[model samples]
Target: MKDENIKKVLLLGSGALKIGEAGEFDYSGSQALKALREEGVKTVLINPNIATVQTSEGVADQIYFLPVQPHFVEEVIKKERPDGILLSFGGQTALNCGVELYRQGILEKYNVKVLGTPVQAIMDTEDRELFVQKLDEINVKTIKSEACENMEQTRKAAAELGYPVIIRAAYALGGLGSGFADNEEELVKLAEKAFSFSPQVLVEKSLKGWKEIEYEVVRDRYDNCITVCNMENFDPLGIHTGESIVIAPSQTLTNSEYHKLRALAIKIIRHIGIVGECNVQYAFDPQSEDYRVIEVNARLSRSSALASKATGYPLAFVAAKLGMGYGLFELKNSVTKTTSAFFEPALDYVVCKIPRWDLSKFRGVDKELGSSMKSVGEVMAIGRNFEEAIQKGLRMIGQGMHGFVENKELEIEDIDSALREPTDKRVFVISKAMHKGYTVDQIHDLTKIDKWFLEKLQHIIDIDEAMKKCNINTLDKELLRTAKVYGFTDFQIARAVGLEDELKSMRKASLVVRSRRKNYGILPVVKQIDTLAAEYPAQTNYLYVTYAGVKSDITFENDKRSIIVLGSGAYRIGSSVEFDWCGVQALNTIRKEGYRS
Candidate 1:
């Protein structure tokens, strides 16, 4: 029943920028407001983060800078008498609050409808035992797990699952209160913390080295479904997706494997009856076709934002439309504007998202990347290939060092041991190991990172070696171009050539490289991320810079005066979504001031 009688909708925004819940919710919430307003519906947003764009004047019809707890939301509902409330746009904070409101009959008391996926469906996915039973009913393979209420039950479940089990709390966000326990002592300790987060804890068999793959699935009330994007974690199952380096449109999966996972994703979303955007995670073994359904996030998640940006698919916009009782075919792609929302996005370029960890800022904090998320921010970079993408992503992380070529002098006795332990600097450590003559197979055995990625890192090291053999004057245009194509900055090239002052060498090299490039008529061209990869005429401005091709796809119009609003690069601890909110507001102000943005 497509009932579109929604007039005034209340939006719950993620309260404050924290580790697990962060700016992604701000992005989603902002998009949801735009979506509702576009449909001629009035929006009332409740968020304490005054720094958010959604809370800015005019974004919402009525803005209450309040907390997202159930009491406050119920009060808002009673006072505003909204027709509907959207819980999917915000992070776990809003979803949990919505569930509590539904349980307490507050929504019913105020006659407010919960838009998007039903509350029961949300519960079914959030509760481990319910999720397992539901998947089992649909003949889907899931990790063997048991939800326990007490320590005794948790102990028994862990013992049955054998040593090395994963403990997860029911309603935790960003894998909070989750970890792998190798023994009873570890299990007890982890479960104690996990139980504090939620009433129930899940003790499941650990698939430590299995490939962690995620699919951003969307569905409508009419059962129309499509995958917006799929991502693969560079680190295996042991690491949280937020803390690990992730790549979109998984590079390791075979064609058959990709389709198989896609089919499974579609099946899971349909079976779960997810009415908006949902992210499905899977653990797949490379040795065979064996795979296990890890879990499903029945809301707009951090991965959803990454997927949207990576593929140029406005997932939050489409999700908000779907939540407002629109079917997939009823809405057009917001980016391409020509394609329907039902069309699955296709990608010609690779996107690498590296987590930015600021562990050094803290004292005595563990730097290990594990089941719990430790990254405060992340940066996404796009390139034609994995090597280029990874290198670009590393630089975009705002870390001091350039790309993967810089050595982090570690006095480690065993390289394999260091690689085995997951850390924020593991990628750089692996690069240093490869530079020290560690083969791909050796590193693979230690780190469990795919050999394909290792070979790509080796390629970077090979370029560094080639650069080392050439002086600034001797560096040919072809070699310099090759280095640039693989995502080496001018400073990195200067460093590789044994320059004392990298800034001076970079300036000199830049001049020479520019003159040589002019002589060879070699230059970078901007390309649009049209979601169709040029298969269809897409009217979109989303773009990336690449030197692989000659023809520039962007055409500038000089008639209008335009201003560019630079966003805070990535979300960090102290300055997060607040800056993003500021950037969004600045763009809005620029447009309002009669300037093109």
Candidate 2:
């Protein structure tokens, strides 16, 4: 009873903002919907969260503000008789629901084909014990670990394994339902909380202080695989990669490590049958430089957005086409009209991403880095040089944006301390460090950023500090001289030195015209990393801190309408919608491109 005429799609979306699930899936799902529409395919989206811009007038042909569950999704499929259902666009909730329906013959009943990866592949990747077994066969190095379902079982596994293990609740994100435990008592308390996220938990040796690295890989049905980009987090092993200041093209990597990861990424994607996009996180122990697999998101993710923006590749759109049986090399490129889909982009510059953290509200949580992600949004800067990239990132997140130092409500001292923490805001702290009396060299050593950039930051800080001590409240001749040397405008120096009146006067003055301050190149610019930036520009002055290599020359000669949605920044408060904002713009752009149901 399978219909050869299957073309319409049913997209499952994760529900609204909640403790466990949030809007990121809506963003990705929205992207897929628009992409399908571009190929003249009808789309039906099922998501309970009506607030998303994706549910608005033109994003999809059929929008059902219904819960994404086995029962409801099956009902829609049976009624609408869509050709396929896409679980990859949705988050874990939708993926899990799709699996449940497939297992129960719900999909078979309607003769619906599941788009993206197959159900068995999803199960093999998710079921920890089975996954580990598969990995063992493949010779992928995993940490010493055990999976347990209950407290007593976990205790038995922990006792046999050892104390001071890492306990992570299954299927949780942002390090939710995850923690470090030293003793049996601590383990019991932590496990109790972790249980809320999933029924099974994984306890493994904590890979603290290791180098955290991520690789975003894309594959197509023809088994054509390519690693889009690699990002290295500033924070060490314990902290989540999203919460760290991440740089692409690995500032410190043995050539072999980089290539090995690239090779391994290809292998894993091919093995898992992931015929679209996936993000793989790893922990490299610095002492031995040994690597261990952290986890993999077998779908479009926040990392995918960052990588897409960083690399200049349209990952989401390409993935949709992959689901349609187009190979990476055969599909039409989206950027460079002359190039074929076969060419994997080669980057000539570095890209850095500084995640934006909203720790200004959470006074109690230690701002120091941790295993879980807590970034609300991230800023991207692009530059040819590391120093320029670093500086650009600082300026992008500062002064004007409420998320950073420009947050007028927060005290300078508090801001200073916030910077001192290993959170994503560390670059701003480094910028402030110049005024705090730390030398450029010392700041570089502390933050692990480049030295050339550190010197410039020190100069900026020195000028501000000098102006503050001089008590030059208004436009002073000496202050201006130093400001020029420190690369600060009169207003910036005045703001630093508490010269509000002088800054106002300087702004009002016609004789001294101050040009726009260029972004300090603190973060990396990806030419091809995030597809969101390619389809559009930032509405507000909010630019992501990415490196110069942040764009990709996509090859598209035909006028095929497509979209790229940004995923929510690793999952933090306040800045969470940064991904959503990108997604919203992508949807708009797709509609503008004449993509319709």
Candidate 3:
């Protein structure tokens, strides 16, 4: 039955900000609360993270600064007696607690409906064995895996799957207690550790060299579905998506492959009866059409927030409406305002998301990129091309990298080893390899990154090489324009031509580059991310800057003065939720001062 009777809703918020799961949930949970309030529903939020803006005054009607475990949620339900409870807005923590509550019949006994994707569907996705069986029934391909209850069973399963398998513990978040085992010894060690976390372990064949791709799928209760966005991991399948450099509107796939994956994503969501947003991950081979469904996150995920920001689609807001019995066609696009939410977002630009790792803060920690997530935060950058987006994203990470080119001196001898091993600095190592005259084919053989992306990196190196040869005093407009087209910054160009040491010389070179670019009319124009690629008249304020074309889409109205507030970039250690709170307060202050923000 449609959930037309939901007048009061309880939202489970991600309790605390940690390494694997953080700020993304705050963004999502806040959006869900706003959507519920717009429908005139009284909202109760249960989140222990007092630092978040979601718990701020007026956001939630009733706020409980409690943990998001089953016991605490059951207490909230008993007291509040909410008409519905939303489990999808929170991270895996809330989903797990909700599932436990359903298993114990607390939700049933209390007459609370678990709105969004059902608890049974969540089980089918979370349980490795059940997930495999359900996908097999739908004829969707999955990697060969075995669920083992003990050490003996794990060894047997590993023997069946062969050497170099992956061990994953059931109910573990962020790929906790998951690792790749090359032989029996490694399998035994990883399995024992995994068993400590959960009762069952999944031993699966490793698709180490395959490309990791993901689709953000949204479905309504009426079976109408649409893919909001699709992303391609810059790093291959061995690394977790959270730790990998990701690009939106996949750069390597052919049209046929894109459509095939999109079809499978829709089919899986429909068969699983997911009534809201779900992220489906895939492992695909670039050489052939072979692919395997990795897994599905039947709730709002980190990828969901990235996809939403990259595409300018309010995923959590639409998902909340879907859970409240709204069909896809019935809702208007909040960004475009002229279109329905049923249409899939089309992009006219590229978005690059780079994971930020603060490994330097901790001592004796491994820096390898594996199935487990270690990134503290990530920054999203948009541009007219891949090179520009990646460079901007690197700068946005606040890691002192002006662009892709390395400023510090490193031994070229280490490039080959760095390429072979996956690390947080792999992209930099690849850049060094390209600068040292390594062929794309050789790097591809060593790193397993796609040749298309390798060529793009080579293009940046080629520009750097050209910059090295240019006379800084006589640098012309054409050269500056070309560099800007490939996403080169003035600081990067100055550093590239050996002017980084002498501050005066570097400043002079930067001024020359900036002046020449401006003289050549090479300034970036602001563009709106209307999700239509300018197919219709879009009335949205979501904007990005690109240097690709001559057209500008921004129209500044001088009639009303506006105060532009910049958000504190990606969340990181030592500087997090507090900045978000400040930004919100700034907007509130602007409104009180009678100015548009």
Candidate 4:
């Protein structure tokens, strides 16, 4: 049955994008608003950000361009009197504001229902002490830590936890006010910052080198649950996920480890009574197969957006429907059309997400990345293999990098020190070290990167070295095909074959390489992303270009004119979700006109 009580809904919008919170919320919020409109529910959205698509005309019934603070939201609640409110679509800002409003009894006074996860459940996840206690009831293994509400308590907890403990602010987002302290002096400085952001702080044993893995899960009101996607960080535990390269469908985990974590994620979400979507993070030691729950985000997060695009699962949209008194079986998967929302998406390709950081715009900012997030935006690339996916992701970041190899050389005084201390230029430093005849095992030992990934990097270096020994004409079709399969673009291949000086211009050399590759019948094929891995017949517009595939999964229709709508590349400063909204609107118009987009 449809929800009769949810005649009108108030949607909280994440305000202006900051360091920790970026355009990911804009994507999630827009999706939630679209879902509400589909259900014929009138929507009132309050966001000061005019540039967002959710604030655009027709996305919501009413738009309030006001601050999302508690007092401001309470006044709007008193005036609008919306029957329900959605807090999970927005980022930490909206979640925090909603919690504050609930604490002040504003939600109860207005008779407004907080949709998705219950307020108490949200509180359990936000407060460090409460989260630990609730998880303990279910026998879940969380980090060894102590929650402190005051400075003295924080000191005592740190002392008990021993030196080199990590301090985290309760209810913080994107790892804000979080850092590792090796001594009491560092502890006091970091704890003061942590206390400023939140009343409660958690001091836990540092798990610096453990592998960080994450799962995006969804649960309906009836307790039907599924894990949509899981991602692994290329950089280990110390660096924030937002500052590391992330890969979906974790590559290094054994089959046993993958299923174990998936089961644990479901158990934790079910025990916590998450009504919609949530993401669970874990720090696992590969050698010992031991792990600890890092934290759980009881709402759509940055990883939620990545997971959605990665596996062609609309997580935010499905979560919104679940919030509206719907079961997973009640809703059909919009992308697959033949499957229910209860079905878990199966991926046939790999996806890599690389963060985009614009730290140069700031003055005297700390360049070293740690627990706190420093990236402003991110890019997701899809390929048939990890090598191709990561290379595409590295180039997609728009950091002037031409994939992993063939980048401008870095001037490092000591390669070992550079690898030991990771900065923004660490990846390039690794490339430089490889050029200096560093072995894969040697680099892996120093940087603590997994041997699998390091070996892949070495393979790319080996290919580049082989290419450098040949000119463009001498680069046979087999070598060119191999390069393309590894996600090397025409430009990168041309430069690798030493064609820059011969052609007088880099663009011309790339054109020559492209023409040669096309003549050799080694072209990219378009493949559709079927959620079931082609187990059953399904149709979807989600697609990616890959050179590894021999045949295209989809065929083109020449009878109808196809309109190609190019979307804004990665989210960054000055341009963000608004551009994405424009592209989506264009596609909608094209589809309405009976033309394929």
Separately for all candidates shown, the number of backbone clashes (residues 3 or more apart, or on different chains) is: 0, 70, 0, 0
lDDT of 1 at 261: 95
Badly placed stretches (over 4 Å) of model 4 are 588-595
Q: Is candidate 3 or candidate 4 better by lDDT?
A: 4
Model 2: per-residue Cα lDDT over 202-261, one tens digit each: 988877656788998888787778787788876666666666677776777779888988
lDDT of 4 by residue, 1-597 (tens): 457889999999888778767778888998999999999999999999877778888889999999889999988888888999999888998999999989999999999998889988888888877888999998999999998889899889888888889999988888989999999999999999999998888899999888999999999988889999999998989999889989998999999999999999999999999999999999999998899998889989999999998887889999999999899989988877888888988888889998888777889988788899988788889999988998888888887657888567557798898898778878888888898899988998888888888888888888888899999889998999999999899988888988877887889989999999999999999988777888976677778899999999987889857899887787777778778778878988999999888
RMSD of each: 1.8, 7.2, 1.6, 1.7
lDDT of 3 by residue, 242-267 (tens): 99999998999999999999999999
| TM-score of candidate 3 to 2 decimals | 0.97
Greater lDDT among 1 and 3 belongs to 3
**Which has the better TM-score: candidate 2, or candidate 4?**
4
TM-score of each: 0.96, 0.76, 0.97, 0.96
Give the range of the ten consecutive residues with the poorest summed lDDT in model 2. Answer: 515-524
| Residue pairs that clash (backbone atoms under 3 angstroms), model 3 | none
Tell me the lDDT of candidate 1: 0.87
Question: Which number leads on TM-score?
Answer: 3
Compute the lDDT of residue 405 as modeled in candidate 3: 80
Q: In candidate 1, list every pair of residues with a backbone clash.
A: none
Candidate 1: list runs displaced more than 4 Å: 408-414, 499-506, 558-560
